[model samples]
Target: MKCLKSLFPTLMICLIVFGCTNEDIDENTVNESSNKNYNSPNYPIKSTTELIVEYQSGFPERKKEDLRKKYNVKRYEKCDCTNSRIEKWEFDPRVDLEGRNELITQEGGIEGTDYQFFYDNENSTPGVSGSTAAGQSDLLISSYIKASNSGVTIAILDTGINLTRLPQSYPFLYGTNSDMTLCEEGEETEVSGWDFVNHDNDVYDDNGHGTVVTSIIIDKLFDEDISDYQILPVKAFNDLGKTTTFTLLCSYLYAVDKPSVSVINMSFGWYGPSGSLFPKFILENPDILHITSSGNDGINNDDNVHYPSSYTSNNILGIGSFSIKKRKEIVEPLPFDSRAMGISLLSPREIIKSTFSNFGVTSVDFLSVGDQVSFYDNNGNHYLVSGTSYAAPLVTAKAAMYYQNGHITPTAITEQLRLNGTLLAYYSLPIYYGDRIIE
Candidate 1:
């Protein structure tokens, strides 16, 4: 997601908890968190100060030995889980703030109509949280539930959620066990997540970035009965809102390894080649849909490549942001809203582009509102946020719903999503928005 530049003013006194959160903030500032643990010696807890070599699989064992002998390596292993042969030899990687979620949020408030779109009726009234992204797409689920997409899971690789803030009424979170100490591959109990920063099982958010982001994934709907849509939160960032490549790699590897997870929402990104390891896994695991923000950087991704976003893999869908403006227009016989609200609009809905959304004809796939969107914090306080960060998850939620309609695999979901997408005609865009999905 694009980094938020400022805060929306006018603090409303309600935590509206229906439909995906609505955001209309400046600089596209969406909240994101930061911590836990690797128990095995081969996969020792990753530290920014610690370094390793990212290599392809099948390099000679002797060559690795020579490198180890030359560098006097502290530890080395060819990781099999995340991706191909990675010669993880010890060195100083100089892990900095590069891995942190670029999402931005300032201390402030805002004034806007909190329009919460309900299950079938319009939740015109906003709650303690804020508005949702659900209505924006004209994409609301059925008044009932089905098992078409049952057993689907979404892995959120970010800071982590606030544990104490679990919902009492219903469950939007997954994993019963919180003990991350016995984090062995394919362990006995179902694992929620691990934090590479603090090297523990506590994936809870220390800074609230992860919590807000996770909320954006499932908490923005008025119909709170979205069962079987599970959230697996992984804390990849630290309290400083920063992380290392190694830490991110672990999170990605862990997420893909899970069979239940068909969709992965990555609202964070870096500027250059994130190595071939991630893309390699994505291709091999074509069943999983890996989606990421085109980046919050306000430059053309074509000219300035943003890794993951700039990747050429078919499984990866690079997303941009657009503040879906509701404009009044006059048709041949009647007047209409450009981006219609309330009941679902027809195919190829009116197109409006967000000035801050990053785009590339070759890289970007879709655009959602990346402006000031509203959501709940760890304390359930309602506030608006913006950025590509929020937009990615809004798309994720929609994709999960699509899977329920029988489009399951990455290939199927991607095509079906584009099939029903809202095509943007306002400008020459990289992403192809269709009429099938949104209407």
Candidate 2:
């Protein structure tokens, strides 16, 4: 079966070559740019931050009106910052005063200069925590009760997954439309995937970030105790972790059509106000679930929540990270890590053991030990890596499990997370961790 699957790609290529003719090729050229629209609005206006503030403040609410009056806020139709408006008096003394003062002095918020604010204090070292290990077992046990991920398709809307790098234990998992029978030594499966970044189907990951995130959700399909799930790979980011709103919009559009895909996992984020391509998708398909990483910027927990996490809709699950050690010890909170809040869940993020950990890089810097390394291959080896990136998958995997068991709809899963998650009081604010408990 495996050998036959390997030959499938070769056979398909040969068929395509023989099936084509000069006229067919010319005809294809005419249809090639059919989807291109030069007049379409450029995605993710570079000045979205200012636009977001305006949109939010412009809402007809009594509170907003009061704030505007008190601050003497003036909405500049166009300001520096990409020809977008800036509200002159919309600042909050409680939240923005200190940061604003620093900005005026040009003394703080400088990317690398503000070490305490910019650095990821959580999981500064990476390795497997007891929570991840236990979570794996919990996934298996949950499978017996419901097979939570079975038949549920999750579209990983991030970087692409390298099917070749997956362990033999999970070889059945193929790329979009790719042949799954021949796990090794075969042409890459013909799995259908779109790259919003390059505007093509070559959604391969130059950086291993997407691969790691995908593994967290899809690992159940390979685990001996639980191998009954499906994952759809959707690439939206490039190697540098940068992606535009257009790419994300394209990815969401694609997932909306995939009947089996009920949930989408997004681990990347930026600073912007709510309302973007994601909300449009939710408004159209109220049943689908959208999960995003609460950003890593070390602001007050609630202050760092990034969109689509901040979108505050029924269909979105905003995820945060908590350090879980052996026997469920909660380590000191990391700086800049988003605090778990309404519709958010906190899971183990510190020092997670995965295939492509950052062991070598951190070890070279004397920040982590090599023994903490989990897996290694031609792809760069990794040690304990920590970020909201890892935390998003933990919640996504649990949601997949829940979906497989028929315990919740994709939208209901978001609500369940909030219901079951732990609530914490920090910095005089209450934050919620949707369903994932430390026990």
Candidate 3:
């Protein structure tokens, strides 16, 4: 039951055995014929009974009230971080939504339903044993890099963070006090992250995905001796790794509300029509760097889009996974002696694309070592997890290091990584800008 890094390659096998299936095909990936086909089988399933509507700037509150009364909204949740421009309205089930889509659009606004997004990785084994505290300490010491401390905060929107175990296990986080959590809801701060799933402030990682993802970011930052940095945990997903667009939007609003938050680490996504409010959220806030996983579906994202990662925002960096010592399929062989036929020769290729990692020439921005990454679960059990989910945090950590050196803008941080990263190519096509973070 010890930490098993060796099983990382077979992580996809575990997911398949566990019955991971693609139930939805996103809009970008769907054929033109399905554009007007709302009832198409490839359409993403709605996760909630709620509908999110974004109104025009300075929209009348009286009109909002009238619309609420007309639509029979049971209650509404604020989807805006700064203002009440966007709201998620929970309509009574008895109300007919036959023409709601068109009516809402005619009200000088756009509306969308919540779609479910899953955590990008799956566990290989059922259990492992170790004190997260000791394992983290060992990890820090082994990956230590000589550098000065810098105060850069990263906000993570995922299955929440392990509040109880994090304070005791990860030295970089706090359990209480002024540095507790940086949630800015209603001009008030909390002791821990805000949980959008249960409508509370308990940011505990029940599914362990958040903890493992957080560990990777912390590991990279700790390696550089960065002690002043802060991590804002925003729990958007539930324990079962199922989350809706409304929940994710709520999480995004909360994360962006904190002005101190410089980067957002989103390791979860979904395949859908790309009509969610998330794309607008990222576009509106260009100050923060958003790093997301491309996906684990081993498909070309250009053809079959993944949310957040496939989002064409300059501020967003979509990351995929790669591994060393992988035997890449040789489409064309290197120049060799004609007599040496059938004898393999050492190709210049040093890394191979992960079999399960999604990629696209324009969608994914970079690739990182996602296989066999050492991480600890929420229950203090060490493990070896693999996915584009883990790969993204590596880039996020590198971006943090760049931010430590005063690279504040997303464009600047991305440029710095590209300049220092290893350029990777496959056959003849260059996959991503910064092939991988050098560190």
Candidate 4:
């Protein structure tokens, strides 16, 4: 060995550095850098990291400090939604029970329409308020191409879907991660999509926003062969109907990689940096089309910048609200343009406009009638709700139907949609998605 080393000194030096690398570890344990012994587990490998909160019973106040101390966390701020007011614009039609003139008790829909299924609860019960969506009427005409609706999945990244709310006929199968499945008591009640807020498998809806949003898709496509379509119910928000972008980000990552999930319906938005990590992920995975609601504040997103919607990613389609028909007494070239860009089927205001919907000339790409939109409620009942949240799923349903019809690529889906739309909100103001997408 000594003679060999002397003969080939440079070669011997290389042997010493490389050959003994793994052998230098503690006898029982292998060194981290050893290629020979190291198992090539796929990684940066994503996994959920939960903050363990432990405290004695009856110690309510101690929960915060205990978690901080245990996790060794520094400068912990509340992980709730930043602007609560902005994110929460969903309004039930029964806000003031007295002014129920817009309300109509129907055994079914209006005489000569196929919209009855869209407004029916589990049993087609009466007492559903508001009116039919003009966007629905517009899509029936404009987007003539009927995509293959088979196997198309849409992830509802909101307050999670209540499986109980769905009727037996609407046999939509939700996703389940056995490892991360959540529960209430001893047993796991509902093992469906992950609850990012509570960190469980019980992705049940508490606030009803998710149910309503999910129903929008069903209402539109139920007439078609929607048997094979999947709905990924991801619960990012909690019972309070509040959640942070971080929570949403976690759910966003989970849904992007799932099989057959090409569409995501995000009905909540606030002023946050969507250009950051979220858009990057969506950009990398261009196959998925993230359709987000252009909030309900009735403000211009060009200046204010509602997040997720305002994000300039082609894959991310931001939708504003508009009614199809003109509201009474309000005459303009841009008729039915709600506060944002509405075409009222019925008016919440002087005529009927989506009273609360954010608009943008540059940021928001498309507009749909969010005013007087009917969706299923949390209690297996149906009601009409008003907001851009309701409007967003209209685009998602179209995107899904488009995907079904062969517009699989995000660019193709968006471009084709834009080309079909007519101009709204002043001749050329609404751009990006051609004139006005849908109607």
Candidate 5:
């Protein structure tokens, strides 16, 4: 998991060489100021109140032209546009249709048959480790919190969640939709969500990475032993566990709009700071809390911090991983070189008894699932899991618990966690020079 850092090529070089220096930048700044009021709307555009409709049966196969005319839909070369067949439709603002899509009967199908409405509901559970003291202790402490997360919403910007695989007894641990049924009268319902990879509403978890992360936070909240927290699963990465900058931005925008969402857990990272899209957004909205991973790549010869985490923002909490004793065995220290100086906390990263860690690592003589191993549930059902991807959720869940109890702010939480982190003499050296061990 070395951080990927490619040197800037010709394009970047040209930008740097002739890019606005202080003298030339003044003219650009003047131009920006002069046009600031022009074309800028006096008020925010009224956002359309739209809902997604998930067809129980996949879209009917028919001539594209005929289908569009009959269903009042439009076919397009791409699905990203407003009039596309799979595009979101805006209904009347005055009407409350439970976010359901109205259906019309066709010559071959029945009319008035209701299909499930798909809203942009961030969904997923957090993966829980059954071993580590922090993991187990947090579970025990959550019981006394008495918070059910009925009103609070937590957004997981990860792979996705497998609703079918979740335990039957703990339905709330799944997401906004509990029974896997359509919108209910009293029960929590899916708010709104999207799949950045497919650009569709189907953000299902093909990769177990997301399922593991989601389980950590959701499981703790809903476990009869702990408090219940609402989950908003926003799938940014695909099966390959990769995503582009644009897609990640879209997911962040969606999280920002979630009315009930108070916290966002981003357990992913990229190298180098390009633009400040995420940081600027968080700065604009100071109330939301963002928790991000400090990255798993052990420190390199150079001591550069990772992006997003490196962004100096009070709203963001960067996290690192540590190893703890589990199952009568002492786990080895994480291979990642730690450089989180200002605000970062280190937690266990060994093969502890987590929902996703089933395979034993021989190198460390530990027995828990690896980043690519599949793990089973308490009942013996199995799924694939791996990575620092899973560790981030454990921290996110604890942060949620702290937030639920009103114990800390986003900035304060990181301060306390880092201040309380067990200091290691091994991390005292300069990561790059690898010589002096400064206290």
Candidate 6:
């Protein structure tokens, strides 16, 4: 189950561990809908009003202040996620955004700014509405499904969770003391999770994506009568499914700080490189298992990189999608003449790659049934949605089951998957170690 190490020679070297600090953040309550206006980037290069800057280790505090003053940084705050290694700089309104981009590019960046980057979530189907109640799929069933005595926690980072719609029968959410309106704040020294999109403790799922994703994990656990696991809900994306790199990093720090959390289910991704310190954060926290979606772009990740999923961290496992129901159309017997037409044929293969799911022998480790999976909205109505987003939680649920069974480390759980997997080919293209249908 060890990943293909040759693909990432650079990451093989140990990374520098950033300095740590306890920085207090001033809570600013903002409307989730207000996030709709932030610059949405399909690629990280797209400009945004917000920028993240990481100062070199042992950099003088006075020099940092001088750089901010020169750039007219309207507001600056240290990221608690990096233990104060990076500062988020918001430019003054008087400075034109284009001018800011020009200055950063032309000057090679401010004196101490070692890295500058932006990040946001990209939905496969952004505004498309799902169909009304289609019956749930039976594709995700696994022998591993069963009740757990140990209370393993999985922090879901996406649009928040809607507790009001969660069924009372499934008492899986962390910190829910039989009160539906409790917001599920963390117990003991833990704060359930944070809502970085809105800058509040209320992690409510107004957009329904998080609710659907959570329901998938719950479904796997509930059907087998498992109820002891805790779900730490971290709202990183807003109602419109947009978020900043600062918020994404903040969510990771929050999840890692909690002692109970062992698994993090990230069902979203974007293409291109991000200059943020996310890879370093994942590298530093090696014990926690990070399950990321390989994305739904239908492109090969080896050619075009995807963040976190393609970061080559041994602890990170990328999950892609395959479908038994979706099929491909093929044309046989090529015609040579101009007036001739080839016979059209439909391939009956059941293990083809989900049309929209991204794949790479190096990046994606496994594939699950992702097409036409059933999920619920904020109002508790059922719908069939298809994406790598839905596919990831199946593996997350399986990982939790393994955790309960004493297969705690990422290496052990990955071995379990390798032993249980069924190798297959997608239209003659062999997938090395995936396409495991949990029957």
Return the TM-score for candidate 6, rounded to 2 decimals: 0.69
- Which candidate order results from sorting by TM-score in descending order? 3, 6, 1, 4, 2, 5
Instruction: Tell how far residue 132 is off in model 6, in angstroms.
Output: 21
16-63 per-residue lDDT for model 1 (tens digits): 122322333443233221001111101112244334454434656666
Measured with C-alpha atoms, the lDDT of residue 229 in candidate 6 is: 88
Candidate 3 lDDT over residue span 224-286, tens digit each: 776667677787877666676666777787778765688899987666667657787888898
Q: What's the TM-score of every candidate structure?
A: 0.64, 0.50, 0.72, 0.57, 0.49, 0.69
Model 2 lDDT at residue 42: 17
Q: In order, what is each prediction's RMSD in angstroms?
A: 15.6, 22.5, 11.4, 27.3, 19.4, 14.3
Per-residue lDDT, model 2, residue 251, is 61
Q: What is the lDDT of every predicted structure here?
A: 0.52, 0.42, 0.62, 0.51, 0.42, 0.62
lDDT ranking of the models? 6, 3, 1, 4, 5, 2
- Candidate 3 local Cα displacement, residue 97, angstroms: 3.3
| Predicted structure 2, TM vs. truth | 0.50
Give the per-residue lDDT of model 4 (tens digit) for 344-421.
Answer: 222322211233556555677777757656544444454555567777887888877778888887888886666555
TM-score of 1: 0.64
Q: After best superposition, candidate 6 residue 62: deviation in angstroms? A: 8.3
Q: Report residue 223 deviation for candidate 4 (angstroms).
A: 3.2
Model 5 weakest 10-residue run by lDDT: 23-32
